[model samples]
Target: MKILVCVKRVIDYNVKVRVKADQSDVDLTNVKMALNPFCEIAVEEAVRLKEQGKADEVVVVSIGPKAVQEQLRTALALGADRAIQIETEAAPEALNTAKLLAKVVEQEQPGLVLMGKQSIDSDNNQTGQMLAALIGAPQATFAYSLELDAEQVVVTREVDGGLKTLALKLPAVVTTDLRLNEPRYVKLPDIMKAKKKPLAVETPDGLGVALKQHQTVLKVEAPGQRQAGIRVDSVDALLDKLKNEAKVI
Candidate 1:
């Protein structure tokens, strides 16, 4: 099986975010960038499949600004066989990205495509689903575990309260969850070997894909802060507050 894993480059989750002066987006001027944490999990899962000899090859693909090639390299270092970057200068949004990925998916014709359920920077969680829809492939989102048989793929997904399983035909799409797999670090030798891995770059126009506006970002601001609450000295006091002071009972 040939696996295509989509990755993204985003501001590191550990770094504090600063909204741009215009409040349209976060400032990336000096912010540290890293692989999307969830996407990394997807990459790790694909690598494991290859190591098990269940997969023939792993192709890591990213659709975003040219800087995203760094993210693709990170996946290659993690054990992907090759990387493809659909270069774009447009701001990161779900529809445009899905469109570009759809074009590449047409060209690559991988048996399976896997990506993260969502990105840390933009938690929209729309790209993978949209891409699957465009390609007319069966999709399993938030998959925590996956098992493939001769003609079908089985996925255990994380639902609100518990897990649910679904079986889909081959050539499907799967979005991974946080506990899907543990990511491994690239050793020094693999990091050096990644330098020579094939990295293909293409533009939106080069892929014959066009953009259409589906939505706009009005502003991005810090989420509302929580107000401090009074502390009770004893269990009885806490019960009293909830029953009478707070008027719940």
Candidate 2:
């Protein structure tokens, strides 16, 4: 069986985000970029399934500009057999991305589709469900653990309070959460080997997916700066300030 893993390129989690001066969006002129952490976990899980002899191949896919090929290479280094890039000038929102992926799913017909529960940049947490809905597949979101059987897969998911388990038939969608297996480091040798792996590029138009904007961003701004704290000389002083100045007594 073939497993398809979806990954995304985003600003490295370590980098401090800076808002643009015009309030259009975050400034990303020359910031460090890396694969989404949760997507890395999804790639690791797909590779692990292949390594365990449960899958015949693990294919990694990403949708973005040419830079996304870098993240796809990293996924290949981590153990994906091949990579596909859905080339686009700008990244699509969750719904259009799902439409593109649904087209790919129709062509590939993989036994399973795995992706991050949400991208760090957007945090929409809707792509997986949208893809599943588009393709008429069962879905398990926020999955931390999975058990594969001949006919179905049981997934343990992180919910609001505790955990929830679900069994999904083959050709289903699974969105991974943080508590899933940790991603392995990519050694220099593996990175070198990944360079030799096959990477294919396609486009939304090529996939016959009509990209349309359903929403518009009015503005983007950073949060207000927090006020500095001060220490009072005594409880009386503190109480007086709270009552008179802050007026929260």
Tens digit per residue, CA lDDT, model 1, 153-205 = 79999999999999999788899999898899789898889989999988888
* Candidate 2 least-lDDT 10 residues: 144-153
Per-prediction tally of clashes: 0, 0
Q: Put down candidate 2 lDDT per residue, 175-201, tens digits, no spaces.
A: 999988999999999999999999999
Residue 235, candidate 1: Cα error in Å is: 2.7
Q: Return the TM-score for each candidate structure.
A: 0.93, 0.93
Backbone clash pairs for candidate 2 read none
After TM-score superposition, the amount by which residue 69's alpha carbon in candidate 2 deviates from its true location, in angstroms, is 0.5
lDDT, candidate 2, equals: 0.94
